[model samples]
Target: MDIFDIVGPIMVGPSSSHTAGAVRIGYIGGKLLGEPVKKAQILLYGSFLATGEGHGTKKAIVAGLLGMEPDDYRISDSFNIAKEKDMKIEFGEAKLNEGHPNSALLRLEGINGNKIEVLGQSIGGSRINIAQIDGIDTNFSGECPTLIVHNMDQPGHVSEVTSMLAHKSVNIATMQLYRSAKGGNAVMVVECDQQIPKEGIEWLKHVEGILKVTYFAGI
Candidate 1:
């Protein structure tokens, strides 16, 4: 673990779980949605639903939906500001096992009819995980522009995508490649240090064996 993880991320906080981790999860959820979350249904599961109010989880989620970072001063008034921004928001309980304590499920709908679903978990010290994006199970922390590539399970596709990123001077942080069956289907969660260009996107879209390319950098 990095020093930040030990001491915690530089952020506004009455509690790291409700504030920083919640904000990060919400921010990543917004990013996964691919646009501003005009309307959202936030379901708090397990620990989040239990102690979320005192930790300001709801307010932190709203802050993230409005594009405010955890360190931003605006996190305190996110609920009031959400109204001014015309964002419709709701809070409720969720169905979850005892897997992760700070878990949440977000159903976000954008203005352009783009719909997305995200399930995230805040472990501790203000860190979280993006467990699932849409129906794909992924392992990413949402610290970068993550590319969740759904493709036919085949050889050389990973190299091709990595080679493209290398040509653009983009750096990959952590990559997790998973397959349900041989030559059937696969998923690659590539987190990058830089934003992906449209040209790169077009290239990846047409790559042989690649079925879908869902890129989520930031909201």
Candidate 2:
């Protein structure tokens, strides 16, 4: 374990899991949306839903949706900031069949009409695990430049993505694959050691059988 594991993240917080981790969950969700967040619906579960208010969880999430980091001084004033920006936000509780206790689900709509749903969990020390995207179960830490590809489960698709990354000289740190059913929807979660070039990502979008591609340039 490193210093962060020992001391937690540098953040404005009453609790690392409730505040800092919640901010990160929001931040990643906004990034996945790929544009400024115009509307957001956040659902907290377990501990977050029970006692998150006193820990500044709501404001922290709004701050993140507004592009603020965990250490942002304005986290406490995020509601006002969001109001000033005309960003609409709503909060509620979530009932899930299975998930970590410190979890939240975010439905975000971007200014450009783009939308995304993210389910994230805070595993302490301000670390997070993004469990699902758009209803697809996934497993990836947002600690690295991550490439999320939604595609048809077919032959050559995996090789195609891997080959492209190989050609780009981007090394994969970790990768996970998930599918709804055979020949159905599939998702590729690739955490890479190097930043993927914008053009490469654009090219991947047009590939046949590829439905969607979302990239997160690490925090």
Candidate 3:
């Protein structure tokens, strides 16, 4: 067995499948939010809904949503942190069966009120499958320097986006594109071998036909 098979993962857990994985989901999703979470609705499905509280999944998730990384020692103190940070948190049962057994449907409103819905699953090691964003199917792994770009599905959109990245000397390590059909709506998910800077993000934001840009570094 390899290291992961042996050690499973470095995490806080009574059960990794339930606890550590939930924490990972929170941490990754928190980063995706781009700001502190002012309010959060965590919907646990099936097994998670049943045993989450006993497993400490709720506390783990709250910690993650507050921008606490997976390896942070402060996870156990998440409740106190939540009070200190003035974050509004709640838990409820969700009937979402469209994902893995350890899945959660998150409705998150950021501190600025810019909100989004994220459906994520913790497969193991706190590793997750970020399935959907705002009702669109996407393939984003919290790995590498990744870019989630939204835009109209026009012919030249991909070229334009990549061209800008090329100009900035960013090499694409992996890329995924999905849309309803040609020229309708689309999202380009790119994982880069190098860091994408603030200046590049500004350039991407100003690009014509670009709808939104979210960057996940060292994913």
Cα-based lDDT for every prediction: 0.83, 0.92, 0.79
For model 1, give the 10-residue run with minimal summed lDDT.
1-10
Clashing pairs in 2: none
lDDT per residue as tens, model 1, 1-219: 677678656799888877888998888888767688789999998888999998889999888877788887889899999898788998888776664778888888887777777888887777788887665677888777888888999999899889989988889988998887788788899998899887887799999899877787742
Separately for all candidates shown, the number of backbone clashes (residues 3 or more apart, or on different chains) is 0, 0, 3
Best by TM-score: 2
Ranking by TM-score: 2, 3, 1
Which residue segments of model 1 deviate by more than 4 Å? 4-8, 152-159, 179-186, 193-198, 206-212, 216-219
Residue 42 of model 2 has an lDDT of: 97
Alpha carbon deviation, residue 173, candidate 2 (Å)? 0.7
Span of 10 residues, lowest total lDDT, candidate 3: 1-10
Candidates in order, TM-scores: namely: 0.84, 0.97, 0.89
RMSD of each: 2.8, 1.0, 2.2
Better structure of 1 and 2 per TM-score: 2
Q: In model 3, where do residues sit more than 4 Å from their true spots? A: 1-8, 180-182
Give me candidate 3's TM-score against the actual structure. 0.89
Q: Enumerate residue pairs that collide in model 3.
A: 142-219, 143-219, 144-219
